[model samples]
Target: MTESETVRLGARIRAYRTMRRLTVRGLAGLAGASPSFVSQLERGRTSASVGMLRRISGALGITVADLFNEDDGAGHRVVRRLERPELPAGPGTRKYLISQRPLQNLEVYAGEFEPGASTGGEPYSHGDSQEILLVLRGRVTVWLGPPAEAVANTLAPGDSVEYRTSIPHRVVNDGDGTAEVLWVVSPPTPL
Candidate 1:
């Protein structure tokens, strides 16, 4: 990396660390680095090798590429359709990670569910996030809270729903064909 790139990377690291409210020592512990080393990296006094950058980004719950792909404009970038990272979304379902890293407080994903497929298995919760589900195609039945609560809502194409994610939630696609939906979350907790 050039000297300018190193400094820019350091600034990005500092920004993310501060956003997560982690002390330099805490981040160092997570990244398996000495606090002094972290300090030097943050001050642009040293350049982190690729392996070191990988460990640090992993500690921050971000991919190593995210460390170098900082958006140049007001945090905006157009994500190409085929470039999204695919993630598991239970049986017969596929999810695409839509937002690049350093997403600030936002996380976005697109999910495609086959008939009877769902974001099931174990219902999950995110303590620091709230989510908006926008159905782009097909239909879904979203269960709020635990399965026992039975609080549910069925959403069709063009419909959207917002919910706090502090309680466990899951969604099922019982429609005839594949279901596609976009999820937008605040204070992004990864999928």
Candidate 2:
């Protein structure tokens, strides 16, 4: 691989690794490689053999081809509407994954909730990711932090919010009709 290609490949590895919350040492152990080796790969200091790429890809729960996908403006990708993957969320809620394949450091999903639908019964906490929810239709109430002391924000169309993933959060369709929302998370956390 060329120097630029190596760097870009390294970035892809770093993105997925962080999304999976794995340290260099952790991924190295899983790939049966050394921490320094992983670090050097991430820093574009070395080229991996097909065998090594397979090991790393296996350790990252992805395929070797995923590491070699054509760059979307250097990892920025366009996820078309029809191409977006559907995800299982709550009942009466339609969710679509927005990140283009190879699953990088970003996780984005668009959701449509019918009346009486919700994200879940309780809030959820995540690692060190940042989350943003933008309302595209109707209304919804977002509960943040502990249930007893939660702060509720009723959002309408065009409304958006940014919050820390450390705080427990959930969404409820507070409208009489269907509601739509776009959620984006950075350093993407698991569902």
Per-candidate TM-scores read 0.70, 0.70
Put down candidate 1 lDDT per residue, 1-191, tens digits, no spaces. Answer: 78888889998888777765567998899889999999989988899888899888876667887788777538458888998889866779999989776666678999999999989766788644678999999999988877677588899999988888777888899899999999998766633
Each model's Cα RMSD? 3.8, 4.5
Write down the RMSD of candidate 1 (Cα, Å). Answer: 3.8
Clashes of each: 0, 0
lDDT of 2 at 84: 80
lDDT, candidate 2, 47-160, per-residue tens: 889999999988776789988776553735677888788987878998998876566667788999999899899998876578899999999999998998999999999999
Alpha-carbon lDDT, every model: 0.83, 0.86
Model 1, backbone clash pairs (residues 3+ apart or across chains), number: 0
Worst 10 residues of 2 by lDDT: 70-79
